[model samples]
Target: MTNGPRVVLAPDKFKGSLSAPEVAAALAAGIRRADPTADVRCVPVADGGDGMVDAFVAAGWKRVEVAAPGPTGEPSTAVYAVHGATAVVELAAAVGVAKLPGGRLDPLGSNTYGLGVVVAHALDNGAEEIVLGLGGSASTDGGSGLLRALGLRLLDADDRELDGADSDVATLLGRVSSVDRAGLHPAIARTGFTLACDVDNPLLGPAGAVAVFAPQKGADPDQMTELEAALTNWAAVLGTGYAEIGGAGAAGGTGFGVLAVLGAQVRSGIEVLMELLEFPSLVADATLVVTGEGSLDHQSMRGKAPVGVAAVAKAAGVPVVAAVGRTLLSPGEIRAAGFVGCYALSDLEPDPALSIAHAAELLEQVGERIAARRW
Candidate 1:
């Protein structure tokens, strides 16, 4: 291998800009331009969110495309990654907020039906294990819609069907009297399910699905109340204890449904991804590690890909830095989170719009800056 400082570039996608691979590629070019002898390795990563599937695909997984419903039941083409008997499914690839029509939030009508369709497809095609990446949701249906897609029937007091798409969750689920799972996909029992997430919020309560996440989906106070009631009713109908489990609130309670209904295991998103990518070994002899995302904010600290990568680098006794689009975090906060240096495109280009548009170029510049400083 070429010799100098062994630099590892591990970053998540710069949302609305470049993909993780693109970011790493740009950085690699710049680092080489600055120091041709430096041994630079690009290990793009994601934390079980929007770019999780891409990460796996970058690591040699096969990409599979399928027609699935969007957040509002619209026709959309989504993709998953498959390798061997395991399939990697990303919720954002199905009913993510980005799929919202006109980019308008649909707090009441959005659901996870599309996500369920993808999972079912994987199971039908003989996938023995599923790793679901949960984040960027656009619903507050407590995953009832997903269950419905998987052949679970929601009935009213009179045994009439209650369609989750018919109305707001409160209006729809409030009338749900029971569920019929006789038609649940046959493979559910045999296939193992794992949830890749960083959320620890429970399914119901002040810190739960509706109270904490609904607002982000554009739920007003009234809608939050309604969704809370809806999820509570759903939990009652299922009669399961998963509503109280950590991460049950993720992806609008998708975690709860998979846990209680499908018997899924939950794990840290980054942890799962890194293990799958065999990331630790890449850092074993690295001289410096650089990781980042689009924005370095409060949310990044909550087990986002960058933070997770930093943790791994630190554990390997490697110096870690971040190259991001923008940062709302202070230097002290960045250091506390294990990053020795934090570079932001915003520092190079003040205009947010311009920064995003030229992220690839700026990231290369950032890479050169890092090399000049570190080497």
Candidate 2:
């Protein structure tokens, strides 16, 4: 083994192109090609959304596959990572956009019941501390589905039980005459929960979940209105205090359900994952740190993985650079985000389609450039 310059490759997934592991592998290959003697370490990171479990697994955590329902109540096998009593459950794994059946969107019909099932399973299996990463959700049920799964019963005025899935949010919550919590999982009281969220939108109003994110989930104007109204009623039932919490609107108000009912603490997804992965120590001995995501733009500077990683690297006095699939930020803007330099796959492949299709190849080239220029 040669005592060469140590290069740490830590990056999030290049969405729709490559997973974080693949990106790190391609970059590592390019770095090795540039200088075979260079010491390279691959540490894939995520912002507590997609690829979260993979990040934990990469760090020697155990992957536990549990059967949960998809957004539309379809059977799905989702995965969570467990290391000792600490478990990490990603909401996207159970009912994310990709998990929708046949690429069909059911904005009002979908719910987070599947995610609740996964969390319940984790707690039942002796998980003491569970980290719930919230994002990429497919529904706007305000997390009623999850709460129901955890043994909360929604009883209608007629004393009929309400189903969390396949029901419109407005109709669902509007019909709820009372909430029953006597059957809640016993382990819930004993477990500690941390919610990994990025956005700070409250659970209602213009800046809230339905108004800002329902459209992307295939909700039309009328559906949005209905969802908003439903969530309003949900807030009333769950107590208006939870509705106004920061990040309470995340994952279609799933954050509210967890925070209000389960009493979970909220935190930045990237920051939480960085702590779990021991990121500071990972870059402590590194000469150059590489970090990025699929895009480096206005959002990237605001609590994204690359920015989060850059902050850590900068704190350790290690120069940080980015290797993204594409970048919308100017060089000055990139530097302002705490990165010393930035590289993009789009730099080599101008076409968006070509860039995504060959992101690994382009990332390798970017990797080579990083080694030649920075290493």
Candidate 3:
């Protein structure tokens, strides 16, 4: 094996166990076990959902706390990071599904209003640009609630304000007064807005927002139908082209609402994350790159963090290895997804909960094994 002194350790959190920082620390520990003098740099990654603030903080962004609404219509506080004039808003921090109580899981009543509150906070804080992380949402309101919070009202046939869910959009049979856009932060008009999403579901169809994601949000068959109908009506009202917009189904049509109403652009969450971390530049001088996430499966091939990191490493001509919590893909699938090789923590720990509980130790051990390997 070549005695190269360069190595880059970039990994996402194991989820429910270690955070991105902890994962990097464990991986670094393992790499050092193999070569005491190796040059290693750890840049933890996130797909715009969980650990996003930490990722930005690790990259030296300033953190600010703001008040936003929770999924249950209660006031909650969220933190965002600011780098220069850009403010990073993570929807998960505002209205994540996990925040909803078990018995109160009502997709029909839930909304992205809390997310709007976060955006408003960011704008008020003097951000010139907004980078919205659209993951881990609990609403299927087609972003209507979010827009309303930002001053866009959804009026029904009698011009009364509509309630939650995209299905409510169908009740509007005519034109309504334009929302007062003047109150919006001046920076919003001049500044760019980017949405970070991993899913590719369009706004409304078989593979679109309602059909694909509503069930996960606790929608029943009837509610899903209502939601789809509302989205269709809402699309007609806005006249925004939802036809080819991929990922419109993400975050219960939050993607759709943001694009149509707010004029936001969508990008791969992982791609955005990698660029934010400046991963390519970091891995360029490294002889090897290691990345991993909670699960390695077919979905990982579809723009998840680890695969995104691997793509960057591959472009730099650095071999990438993964130490995953579990292996859900076949051997062929893993190689095809741009990983040099993969190791499962489950293989070492056996029990799922135990594997997560000791994820750091397991990752460190796997990292040691990789460092010892003569490749």
Candidate 4:
């Protein structure tokens, strides 16, 4: 029953380990153990990727469970969050590469049709604002599958429907003649669709999705070349320059194709999630803010959740400390990003795998150490 500095805890998920809420709760517990008098506020955040549904659910949104399409063209039941007129959906949930059998990676065969199914569900259920998190996708298609799902006709030169499920990438993209919008869902035109994009890569060029990200998805040089050429053609037929738009390469070109269809707006995923949670108002009077993620690196500054939290706390004149599983950036780099301090768990444990295996214990220690620092 004591009052100390008000601390806000906002962290992204620890990649393959803890969820954002779990990380926040563990840190908060450690902080409380170190100083029972410390006031702590726990708010989870994401960079418009995984953990989005959980974050919104923690923020009081209803978790709506339904079956959407997986990357392999099969029905994969995934969950999306809905509250009032706003609906939150993650492309990964519906069409993540993890959905492939035996973790089979298929860039050409994968599609976004299941994602479109979920979007239609949200619209039919009265959602006006659709927030689409674009990350962890396994496909490299130019969102042609999603268009097909929404009743758009993807045709070849012979007026035959292009089969996203059965056809390979070469056949699908190489044969695409035109897109028919006559069957597009009516709600698609009226609803405000926003893409939660973390990366800034456009749809084409060296930094495009194919060149930069396709390798990780099991694409060889030949596959990448073909996919790139196919994506270029798909964009040409779609009749929009979404290919050059920043963030257009996200989620296998879901950003480009979806944005082209509705003229959607792109925003930083972390900022969108924070604003959705009203995080600034929650931390306005806090003495300090604590945030972190799995890794602190040069990329973290480029729109990751921790950096986003640091921006808000710094604006409110609150000091920020981050506790991370590991760090690839120098202390100066983090300091320049407005983080006053960071605790690295990788240093605490010598074994890399053991560190992630025991991340919870190490993170709690970090929280205690951060709290015990004499202020």
Candidate 5:
């Protein structure tokens, strides 16, 4: 009745393919294959972003679906999760880049208004505490649109009422001069918000969201400049210097806006997620911990889910290993990341397409090898 070594399988999604649970299952299956009696525990994780809901759901949070606006003033829906008084909202589900119309990615036109809609619904459903996952956001409209969704009265320089919901980032924030909080959401006033952000970029500057993330979201140079100026104006109009603070640039300025208007506190997505998943308790007696993402790169060290998982494992004195689909970091970097070793799918397949196409089988193989490693 004695099982093999106790190994914890915790990994993020492979992106464009396997999900965190799927990846964890594949890894677990491999561990089982290597040692048929091995005790495997799967606790998939995410740093906010797309896989946030999956993590929460796996942790037993109840998911609720709601109709909401998209980033670009279109019909869209967002999924909200509840576990007692705590509710989770994912920006990606509301207005993520994937939600954009076919072949249409408009960085300047999108906003976080959809996120506000989800928040409002959560408040209405008796959530006293809210967690907003600020990943996969498709808007750079500052928090103007989000605040608007929460009932803030946006006005132009002429003191006329302006619609932040249907307005573009530049057009709306460009015309705004002042704000009226008299009509702000009552629930927003009573609720406390915790922001789940993966990045530490500020609201404005070279490393800021606009400068670094805009391009990834499909904004050209001219559009970036224009959006930045509008964000600058939006920040000034709101009068919160938190724009320059770290994490302000997350989700296209949703972080900055939420922090400023809602008085929300920002924390690393993995940090928050660990507490939610009770990671330390689960890993306390484990012989080893396994984690990974789609690609292990230089960015992984900065607070990605795997790094966060390793931090927890290191604290518990458990050795950490990673099984990634691909890796762009060197051996030195990998060792520096606190991984005793890494198993990359590409190393086995040597073909990117084959690795992705056969990720499950490859991941299973990596898992078996990790279990087989004596150390």
Candidate 6:
């Protein structure tokens, strides 16, 4: 133990490769193989998406069930985690893109009505503060649906309730009522709302949510442009200009909705996760830290999980190494972003699918080799 380097196996999930806990477990296996008594700490993290429940659960949060709307306007029940008085709400739980069937991938028709249901449930359950994870959304309603579910009214030019369809925006003339602050749990009105998002794209622009993300949500070129225009108009009606808010475009405009309508304060999803996990203090005593995600590329430089981890390690003057599934950025680019080195799991196994299937084993092997080299 004295001869081996003290390491922390902190990594986000490799997406299709491994879960965060599994990644930590595999890294622990490799560390132990290299030095039987090596000190290793595993703190799995997520940027408020699929792995959020696992991360919060591991950190001692209590899970609660609530009824919410589904992606297709059906009734659904979702789960939120409570840590002390704070509630954790993940948009993915109610209306993630994964919840939609391949045949029903209609961005225009889907809405964030389910998200409002979850928030209302949290408030009713005595949660004062909300930590909303606005990642992996399936809706494109510009939050109008969510506001409607929360008791706010969206009226057409003729003063009728508007549907969540894309065509409804053209008919929407204004918001007719204020948010229902009544019966708002005493804890909620005074509590801070922290929104977690990974993207930096603003509400509306070339790099905004619709332009950059609508294609992935199954929008054609025309639909993308139309959605952008619609959301821009929606923002105008709400009197909140989202044209320049960073991360405003996240989660198919859900970010803009929560920020504008709910009065939420935004923070980088990865940065919030790091703070929640107390990553800075953990890195201070470690000699080396290993972190990665499914892919590491030029985009990683702009606040992705791996880069967030590297930033913490870099600040503590610890050497950070990344073992990723693929490398889109060169070694120099990674180094400049604060990672000392990067190794690809794909290089060790040429087949992409095989590498993902054997991710835990590959990561463990990589960790063991790195530890051995240090020794």
Give candidate 5 regions above 4 Å deviation: 165-167
Off by over 4 Å in 6: 1-5, 102-104, 163-188
Clashing pairs in 4: none
Q: Rank all candidate structures by their lDDT, best first, as comma-separated numbers.
A: 1, 2, 5, 4, 3, 6
Provide the TM-score for each candidate, comma-separated: 0.94, 0.97, 0.90, 0.96, 0.96, 0.89
Each prediction's whole-model lDDT (CA): 0.90, 0.89, 0.78, 0.86, 0.87, 0.75
Cα displacement (angstroms), candidate 3, residue 35, comes to: 3.1
Q: What is the RMSD, in Å, between candidate 2 and the native fold over all Cα?
A: 1.2
Instruction: Report model 3's TM-score to 2 decimal places.
Output: 0.90
Angstrom error of the Cα, residue 81, model 3: value is 1.5
Clash number for every model? 0, 1, 1, 0, 0, 1
In candidate 6, list every pair of residues with a backbone clash: 128-187
TM-score of candidate 5 on Cα atoms, chains taken together: 0.96
The TM-score between candidate 2 and the true structure equals: 0.97
**Global Cα lDDT for candidate 3:** 0.78
State which candidate has the highest lDDT: 1
* Cα error of candidate 2 at position 153, Å: 1.0
Winner by lDDT between candidate 2 and candidate 1: 1
Model 3, 139-178: lDDT tens per residue? 7777776787777766555656654443433233123323
lDDT head-to-head 2 vs 6, winner = 2
Instruction: Name the regions of candidate 3 deviating beyond 4 angstroms.
Output: 1-4, 102-104, 160-185
Lowest summed lDDT window (length 10), candidate 1:
161-170
Please name the candidate that would achieve the greatest TM-score relative to the true structure: 2
* Residue 256 lDDT in candidate 2: 90
Return model 1's CA RMSD, one decimal. 1.9
lDDT (tens digit, per residue) of candidate 5 on 46-131? 99889888888877889899999887878978797789999988899888988888848888778878888888899989998898
Least accurate 10 contiguous residues by lDDT in model 5: 164-173
